[model samples]
Target: MSTVLTHVTDELQSIFDRARSVAVLTGAGISAESGVPTFRGGGDSEIWTWRGRPVTELSSAELIATDPQLVWEWFDYRRGMLTSVEPNAGHRALAEWERRFEDFTLVTQNIDDLHRAAGSLNVLELHGNIWRARCLRCASTFEARESPLEENPPRCLACNGPARPDVVLFGELLPDGVFERAEEAAARADLFFVIGTSAVVYPAAGLPITAKRRGARIIEVNPEMTDISFIADVTLLGKAGELLPQFLKERG
Candidate 1:
């Protein structure tokens, strides 16, 4: 049983050729291809729970304050899981695009460090990185990549204070400056890519519209139809790991 291949349109190819400043927004779907389960997706129920408590409950600011050890333990388990996952083809393709374009910005909702691992330099992480920890006292941050980290609720080197995962927890606001930069990139882009996202989560969901309002062509790459799919100049329906590489090849 063979499925018909979806070919990239000549119009899309032409848009790629003309694009100089490119901005991309990626979501959990991209990392899901690399075996990291999305928050709303299924597979390993264990990833979402610890001792019967939901990760959603364990990963909040309130939880961090009440039970920092439990929160750190859950994050440590997740970090261990991510240790074995590597950047997929989609990540590699974006990294390549950054090198090819005059100005490239990769904005992601994922906490996974896979984009940086894949060699992307200019990335704006909407949700902070899972591999980094922020000091509750000093507000300083440092990379904490060691899996099953030596310290649960790792302490800050600067102030002997408790730290939490740098990720934007449930109910927490997106870090200052990150979203502003993303909006700037969106406004400046000649081409905007909405990749692997459901296009429902705002402020991030609003970026595609911002780019479009600024006259950037919106190209959506996703397996499912998203909330913003209606605005896409072209929608390439598929997994990003496959479609992004194919898009690059077609443009070449």
Candidate 2:
């Protein structure tokens, strides 16, 4: 290992050895490492190009209420692409780390179910999963093996209202209880890691700051610098898949 890697590994090792509570915040970058495309990178553009318009223009409750089929088709198209990818090594490393810490929490902004697919049990999904859909009327959620309803949006089994992907869309708030738990985890963390996130998205962006304020040592594990990199006690710059396993294995 290089001198830089050795120094960072020792620093992280010291913290992990002593930490009783640890929290990780992940974003689209992490998922992208495992073949998931960035927003506006590919998948998102296709969704927009499908109708010769932007998804942002139609990604609201009003749009869902007005033209549910259009919204469902967009999500269905994305889900179809998702079925072809699998979790990468970074995901597996985090899953293993979850077992190493009794109080470890993994908070992610990704709507993909890749973390769960990688065997992470205690994930706090800030954005709801794409593989699941929620009823707009009855508020019941169901899983879709393959785009639950394709040509037309499905109706709630109970109330017969429109069912939509359970994600936090353009105008919707995050699912209940997710932010609360994430905030609490941040506040009490002995060690906090912001992994693969750009850290620009608000409310979610406030989490690492919350951890910093509460005295948790911050380590950022991203291949590139983010808005929050200036605040990190240690920023190990590289892909989470390449850096994380090495960070864990070589840290002394």
What is the per-residue lDDT of model 2 for residues 1-252, given as tens digits with 9 covering 90 to 100?
112232245656777777899999998888888777676432342234456767785567777878878888888777877888999999988998898888999999998999999999989999888887788888999876565354357766678787887888877788899999999999999899898887788789999999999999888887766678778887778788887676468432
Give the winner by lDDT: 1
Clashing pairs in 2: none
Worst 10 residues of 1 by lDDT: 1-10
lDDT of 1 by residue, 52-139 (tens): 9887898898888888888888888788889889999999999999998889899999999999999999889999999999999999
Q: What are the root-mean-square deviations of the candidates from the true structure over C-alphas? A: 3.3, 3.3
As a whole number from 0 to 100, the lDDT of residue 92 in candidate 1 is 97
Clash tally, candidates in order: 0, 0
> What are the runs in model 1 whose C-alpha is more than 4 Å off?
1-5, 41-48, 250-252
